[model samples]
Target: MRRHELPRTHAAGRTYLVTGSTSGIGYFIAEQLARTGAHVILTARTAGKAELAQRAIRHSWPQAQLSTLSLDLADLSSVRAAAGHLATFADRLDGVVLNAGVLAQQTRRETVDGHELVYGTNHLGHFAFAAQIYPLLQNTLDSRIVTMSSYAARWATLDLTDLESSRAPYRGFATYKRSKLAQTIFAFELDRRLRRGQSSVSSLLAHPGGALDALSPKRPPMPVATTAQVLRARPLSLIAQGKDKAAWSAVRAVLDPQAHGGQLWGPRFLRSKGEPRQERPTAAMTDRVVAEQLWQLSEDATGVKWPSLSQPRRL
Candidate 1:
């Protein structure tokens, strides 16, 4: 079953929020969701980009129910404010996608909150933002939360002693990989928490392989600038799977009722080309005990308590 080829069902009254929707894989996801008649909130750091994306969608689907929301994932305060504002406009949220992330950057940098740029935007900011929208997701029927992880995550490992990577030597690619691994692990942890609380929402994890698109503004700088420029100039869309194909992995995990929770999906070809396939997390991701500890550590680092999961569910 292909993602775009999946059954076309109307999501008339349903609402979805897609971060980093202004460009790349996230943009395509938002466009497809809008086509299905979802009240889609397309988010980006700048209002200009957000509006441009909204307009682009409307141009294609005049009746597309899309709105722009500004959110800077690199900054925790910005994330909190954006999530807060979203709550006021929507009564319930059916889908939430953490699609924004930094790619390969050459330099080591920190966000406004003094956290590493890659980890801050890709993990901490999203981790906290999702927690803030706890209530809205709870109110929906069979809600879904999708977080994007990359195949590069295979190389990522958790450094308990240096979770922030401040103590250890920093390599650009290594940092990105580590953050992606955290994203997958965090998804599993979120699912566990939701189930424990008896919440209907299912937390899902996915990734777009070497798809041709940017993620978020806070994306890591390209480690190999020359190679990137060469590839771009050559218009190498032929070399990798299109962004649309890559995004299917996410669409399947989010919409397919039969799909399992806490699984990763990627393309079959090298770097995820062709149709998406099921991918298991590394042994590190399956370690429930470690996942729990990591979840706690993330909360502590971000200073965001998951209010929705604070109390046990009363049957």
Candidate 2:
């Protein structure tokens, strides 16, 4: 299928939570779900953005079932508060799109939690949110948690000793790559744990090929003309697709009935943009040792324990 012709999956009556849904790919994901008659819980960093998103969706689908939550993935407290608010909702979540993230910051910074801003917001924040709201996911049958990764993950070299980038010199791109790698690792590890516990909730990973925009304020500015020219000369630029096309991998990962735990989905033509399809993750992303270590580190860093699945709950 062409990029604009991506197929839709059945989602009527199901409730989905999509972080950073006020604009860009996350907005489209929420809109698509709402279009299919699903009740969409849209999250934003502020109430204003959330209101705009809701208005946009309502403009397109007057009767769309929608609710908004204020969440800042950079703030662990915000994530926890959002989870607490989410628990008050009347319906069980059918899925969650862990799509909030930062591309890269111009300078090294720290979150309020005192970790590298990029790593903390892109990976750790989502880690805590997913873990906290996991029981709600578990309560739903065949529910999914889709963690958004990036093409940069393959270039990352994770050092277990310095997951927070404390010991190493900070390079913006390197830090961002490691964060994406962490996301993929967490997704796969969560899948493994869920399987071990005999739970039905699936954990999936996806990357937007070259999609440029997301709702988060932390997104880096577009490259300058000279930089764009240099990038266009590189082979990777050939696969650079629009944001809408880039979101397909994530949309498919969430709604495709055939999609399963531990699968990595992205554009069909490797890094180049095309129809979404199952793709192999990097060796680092699939390494059991790396995944386990990252999981432990996430639990330690976030102070959120993974829920026990000894007794799987049916929706």
The most accurate candidate by lDDT is: 2
Put down candidate 1 lDDT per residue, 107-153, tens digits, no spaces.
77899999888988899999999989877887786888999988888
Residue 41 error for model 2, in Å? 0.6
Clash number by candidate, in order? 8, 0
Residue 22 displacement in candidate 2 (angstroms): 1.2
Superposition TM-score, candidate 2 onto the true structure: 0.89
lDDT, candidate 2, at 111:
91
Candidate 2 per-residue lDDT over residues 184-206, each given as its tens digit: 88888888888999898999988
Q: Distance (Å) between predicted and true CA of 241, model 1?
A: 1.0
TM-score each candidate: 0.88, 0.89
Task: Point to the candidate with the largest TM-score.
Answer: 2
